[model samples]
Target: MARWKIKNVSVSGVAMAVPKNVVKTAELGLLSQEESDVFDNTVGIKSRHIAPDSMCASDMCQAAAEKLLEELGWERDSIDVLLFESVTGDYRTPPTSCVLQDRLGLSENCFSMDIPMGCCGCMYAITVAGNLLTSGNVKRALLLIGDTALRMGSMKDKSRVPLFGDCGTAVALEYDETAHDIIVDFHTYGKGYEALMTPHGGFRHPATPESFEYEDFGNGIVRAPIHTLINGMNVFSFAISRPPKSIEKFLADYNINRDTDIDYFLIHQANKMIVDRIVKKLKFPQEKVPYNLEEFGNLGGASIPSLMVTRIADQLRTKETTLLMSSFGLGLSWGTMCLKTKPMVISEIVFL
Candidate 1:
């Protein structure tokens, strides 16, 4: 129930890095001909980038952050805060953000932390970064969020396998005293936490040999508890329900006109179908909703930033537009935000 407005912060730039490897849902033997057709035509997944086995999520993030730092001409020491948001970290201990600080050659004084959440993470990281900058002590922050959700599922599991992609992104934010406020509305429903989770890898179900045994979950879907478990129906229900409702309330409460006040509605690219449903539910214009999942599948925490970089980089670089973003995912957590974007250096999507 966190409802607040934060000011004095603006996103300076956004950059994303995805693996060079391409994976088409059609190419993966996981889906049958009909499923593949549906996935490509209606569900919006055509191809996705898959990191090599040797690469971890942090590697992609570091690549993105490295390029962003260079482009923004930001010296390593000037970044006072860095937030890494993702469930897939290099290790369970030390927190990935701390490790990234060393890799990126950031100053030891940087306040770094990890937000171990998926999908809705980028915005959450922005929220944390904004708060820190407004505290009057911090100047600049690098907000990184992404994961290898595509790597979490067994290759043969058709249902979940084709629906995810691997990615890493960085959204740089700096304090600007005259910047307009960012309004965000947050909602949490712990009841849906189990709807999307790896039930066997966390503390309560720490890795065990028995956990590696694959079990069939019907509909040609089979996986071990160690793999990411997504209850499609439940997740779909939550996605199509909560985010739209929350966004409606967000717009209404702010007296923002969807048709005139906002230039774009950049939703977490879960899929074309889900975005369409939300669009249909809200009676929002379809043309203003830009999407990239058609080529990249669903990129977990990286979706929003990736979406911005891939689909609207040029517009964001030159136009001062109003945007409303809605993101929802695991934790049954979701949020809606509206901000008038200033000119930002949006880098082209990088394939590492």
Candidate 2:
């Protein structure tokens, strides 16, 4: 059990940018009419945004960051640290964050790096950013999370392709002497690493032309070894257990009530079945837990922040809110966090 109480770190702004190319499941010929209806109702994914081949994860991240920096009216050089979290970076070398620093025109003194994580990426980024701010070594930090990898998925994979959307988010955090503490808990089960993975393009399995060879497993899902693969059953089992339990324990330890103490539960938009199961197990009210999966599908680690920007931007901008965020999947990691926002700036969801 890894837990931390971060003080004097608060979010100043948040912004999300999704590719303009909207793709509804119906748009794909792979799914039957009945299957499309089932996916829409059960998965809650009516549509998703797909980035063009020309657009990389960094492009959307840069878009959101530029807009957030502009909206917050902060000088680029004022940012002291930047972490770019994503599974599909522009390249395998020269850390993507380094390119982002140049794209955003940040100071040469700013510390920049990349964190390669999937669904758990954003929460991990935010947690790390908060801890760094605790040291008072940095005045402000930028956490950029998103993924364009789904666009790289094999088009024939009926199971995983429709479950994803491309999105990038920029969250601005600054050191504050008076802000309340941010509580976070983390857990991992590396044994399930194979539950969800892309087997090639890494040093362990360098990409080869044969990596694109197709193998149909008799199931509807087809994968080229290089494409993302998922063990849906195992992933569903993991999601329905850890996330709800961790959050329940978090609220219990903090003496916070699920009914009222927490203003909202911004969980990873994995799917309707997984999300509804977690909510029911925790006994949290449905109204307080909003879902964008119907319109945005799963944005991986970007889902939580993307949910805030796309669904509750007005509420977050108008009043102080206590947010309970939970993230799980890929790396087989799960994390739950409790954060209080003091009416920060949340920009309109940018489409590009």
Candidate 3:
């Protein structure tokens, strides 16, 4: 149980970016027209924005960060820390955050690093940034989180190709003694790590010539070793079970009243079935949990922030709201974060 409360840091703004290319579920041709319709209705993903080969996750995050900084009217030199989270970075060598620091024109003294995480990454990254601010050494920080997961799947694999989207998000935070506390609860189960992963391309099993060869796994699932491999049933079970339990414990530990204490529950947009099951198990109000999976698909780490920008930006920008966000997946990890946000800038979703 890695849980703690951080004080004196407040979220100032949020922004998101996605590729301009919109790929509708019907266009994938992975399923028959009838099956595609069923997938769209049951999974709640009708379309997704996919980045081309020329675009990388860093590019989208830079776009989002730029927009957020401009809207917040903050000088780049004022940023003291920068954190970039993504499973798929621009390269295996250079840490993407360093490149972003230069790209964003932040001060040379600014602290920059990369956090390679998956679904629960945004909340985890926020916690990391919040703690840095609490140290009193950092005055302002920017959190950049997203993934180009759509590019990691084989187009022939219906189970995965249609279920992922590319997106990038930026969150601005600054140290403020008067700010509300940010509480985060984290849990990890390494035993279940294999539930979702890309087994190839890493040092453990460096990519070989055979890694690029596609294999038919039946049921319209076909992929290369280098592509993502997900045990859907295992992942579904973990998503619906562990995350809800974690959220429940978090609420009880903090003595939070879900119906009154929190204005919104921004759950990760994993899928309609998984999300619905978790919401049902927790007995959380459906209205308070907005769903953008229908339009953006599952954006991995970007799902939660994308929800703020796409679904509740207006509310978050105009009123003081208490938000509780939970995300679980990949790394067999789950987390819940509670924070208070005041009326602040939320830039329009940038399409690249």
Best of the candidates, lDDT: 3
lDDT of 2 by residue, 53-94 (tens): 898889899999989999999999899999999988988899
lDDT of 2: 0.90
Against the true structure, candidate 1 has what lDDT?
0.89
> What does candidate 1 score on TM?
0.98
* lDDT agreement with native, every candidate: 0.89, 0.90, 0.92
Candidate 1: residue 4 lDDT (0-100):
69
Report the Cα lDDT for residue 48, model 2: 91
lDDT of 1 by residue, 161-255 (tens): 88888999999999998788899888999987889988888889999998899998788889998998888899999999988888988888899
Taking all chains together, each candidate's TM-score versus the true structure is: 0.98, 0.98, 0.98
Could you tell me the lDDT of residue 267 within candidate 2? 88
The per-prediction tally of clashing pairs is 0, 0, 0
Q: What is the lDDT of residue 201 in candidate 3?
A: 96
The deviation in Å at residue 200 for candidate 1 is 0.7
